[model samples]
Target: MLKIQDIRELIKAIDQSSIEEFKYEQDGTKITMRKERKMIEQVQQVVQQAPISIPQQVVTTVQPQVENIVEKEVKQETPAVKPTNLHKITSPMVGTFYSSPSPDSAPYIKVGDQVKSDSVVCIVEAMKLMNEIEAEIKGEIVEILVENGQLVEYGQELFLVKPE
Candidate 1:
């Protein structure tokens, strides 16, 4: 039998890589993980009596005036400063963010702390595995965006770093 931690590590490895699905069987036990859940959900809906309706945000409209107004609002919200200069360390997958290796330990990095390209800044726990997140750039940490133990989405900015 595989240890719980070993299973967790396996799940984490599959989650991080480009592979979308994984399966394993040993001694009559089988485990499977699929990154794409939408296909599975659609299959489930077909089997069930109730069909799920997802509303589409896009609408066919003849009004150019409304489109212009929305475009203007979008342009105004995106400023041409600070954000472009800072390096964002984004989450690679959806998971729970952890600032430290364990609850009792000091956080991996804090604002103003120096980090190298290979420095481990934090951990993102997915499927029970603690996957260490690297800085991937030489920099000084500018901000820690997420709170400890918060659920984070894929590509969500977790930290801002001022690259050296």
Candidate 2:
């Protein structure tokens, strides 16, 4: 049996890492995951019983923050100006990231999908409650920062958009 605080801590730690997906299994218990990328998106965390102990393997895959590092190295070549063209849609809560309403449903938006404000872009389920996330700024979804079913943090970036 796992304590509530233990699971909460694990969730927090996962949110801070570059790894976008993670799962934990022990004997008859299992936990599935999903995370948001640029902004706030909801999450659906499902815990259930398993017939066998699902092997515990932590695989990390993150879109590198390479630009940040490269910027430091090329201090002289930089124009010393900031980019002002990108707009971000953020999650209002900490949860999972989903491109569709359900597993069998088609995603609302894809990488190149053009969208308007108030468009439902994804769903995040937390504490067994599903929440719909909307795009408040019209734009093209440039990058999906999260993988399906990964856990996320409060105020996390869910999407990167190029505003129209």
Candidate 3:
């Protein structure tokens, strides 16, 4: 018989494991657990950052799983768009978006401002580090998609630019 504690322990084990899903059945009782895709991705990212050595066979097996996760994430993040001349400046990493270098300072760029390819447009703070985001394309700022100090995700659109 599976008690609530037993099920909870099983879930904890699964969360800590590399396996994506688990199932068990006996005496007409069945239990199954599956980790969310995002959780799996976060685990994979942490594992990649560590210098732990993995067996060749394990590496080969994990490659396909990682590719699948990346594909799913890309599909979810990308939206269909009608053909437009506007170029979008996107967030390079997940963080808190800031328009100005400091609270009292003017914003880096505002609507109708012309920017060069290397122009600093905004900052994104992650893990106490302030990352200056840039306009990778030469253009005029048409729209600002994020408000100052808003949380943003990787690849989220920050500004729309009409190419020069």
Candidate 4:
């Protein structure tokens, strides 16, 4: 298994070299990383050269339409509004979420379950370590946002609670 320092060193080495992608596998663990610098550079080049090839009048006419389309896409991707009174319990690190301590066990908390601030709500496994996640707020669990064994990102909402 690669240590945290080793992973950081690998990232630095990849950044210094011209390699666009990297993959490493050891034991049962796998790591993959890629650089999108080339694609971004190409996009920037096209944008920089656009005004030179096109007439000013046509550019002015097309730019507004492009902006409108982008605006619409952004609006469509926005998530549904959350309730103002609910407190969100978010993941502290990127990891796999586990609802139960073991496969055969019941979940730590379920919908409508009342919990204290120090109550263990779930577990997030990162780098083969089982990290107990706390509620952090005295409340009733109103929702569970992720399923067992789901991959979760840092700051991603895992539960919504209604405060007592």
Candidate 5:
């Protein structure tokens, strides 16, 4: 059983030593020190001028709060509707979007290129493997949504397909 007087004595010793931090533990008591630069400088000036010791102890305990949410009862804000003119070709997996399968080869397709269903539109590089993404609809490519060598997230739109 450690008494409060022991804590006072340890603080006094720390003040006399001119140290920044001090820690001591005896049985059930654990005392930790955090020294402020301004307080230390003031104490040093006072000690040099008159040599008086003051000990102040502070203990802080914080309990983490848990967030409670009832989904059925919670009022959620719905996003405003967005209008899309062209049919979008979205990535099925996370990968680097590639216009061509090989570096020296011409791009599989470009904007204004007409494509049939099952035609290879682009290749996506995922985990060192090249995946050929096919055009699901026979259409003219209206726009390219992403650039070659660009990092594409899962379900990210890659191209805009307009049916011929």
Candidate 6:
């Protein structure tokens, strides 16, 4: 029989791995694990339910009389610069981001802080469990892309790091 710790280790391995499904059986004791497709469907449903706000903001800010002038001025402004050497740290699963282990504790990382491969950079809370995310690469943190407590999707960019 599989112990609780063995099951937990299996789950962790599944979470960190690319495998979508797994099954095992020994003497009629069976175990099965699969990554749910419902997650993507739920995300799509939430997106559809949420109202689009960007167009409303633009409409409220720009007056009809000066719209043309403002459009030209906006077009002329320089676009935000994206660093070429920066590597994106993305979310491994859908969850809420926590910068610190606890509310009263200091954050795991900050902008300009150096990190090595295997360094725990933040925690993601999913289904009441806290999963610590590692840096996976040696780098200096250049930007934090999500706010604390923000819900992040699978593969969403969480931070930008300039590799050492």
lDDT per model vs. reference: 0.80, 0.72, 0.82, 0.84, 0.72, 0.82
TM-score of 5: 0.49
Per-residue CA lDDT of candidate 1, range 4-41, in tens?
A: 66765776687688788788899998877666545644
lDDT of 1 at 47: 41
Instruction: Please list the residue runs of candidate 5 whose C-alpha ends up more than 4 Å from where it truly belongs after superposition.
Output: 1-85
State the weakest 10-residue window (summed lDDT) of model 3: 32-41
Query: Per-residue lDDT for 1-164 in model 3, tens only?
Result: 97755665675577688888888999998766565455655766675577566688877989888679668766755656734989999998766799999999999999999999999999998757999998999989988998887767678899999998
RMSD of each: 10.7, 14.8, 18.2, 8.3, 26.2, 10.3
lDDT of 6 by residue, 33-128 (tens): 766445645655665587435576677776574578546645644356888989999999867799999999999999999999899999998767
Candidate 4 lDDT over 16-132, as tens digits, reads 888989998889999986655646457556755665465788779899886786587556556678679999999998778999999999999999999999999999998889999
TM-score against native, each model: 0.51, 0.55, 0.50, 0.55, 0.49, 0.53
Off by over 4 Å in 2: 1-9, 14-83
- 1-164: candidate 5 lDDT, tens digit per residue: 65545545665566567698877677766666644455544755564577433333211222121112223212232333433666788998766789997899999998999999899999887667899999998988988988778766678899988877
Clashes of each: 0, 21, 0, 0, 0, 0
Model 6 steric clash pairs: none
**Candidate 1 vs. truth: CA RMSD?**
10.7
Worst 10 residues of 4 by lDDT: 35-44
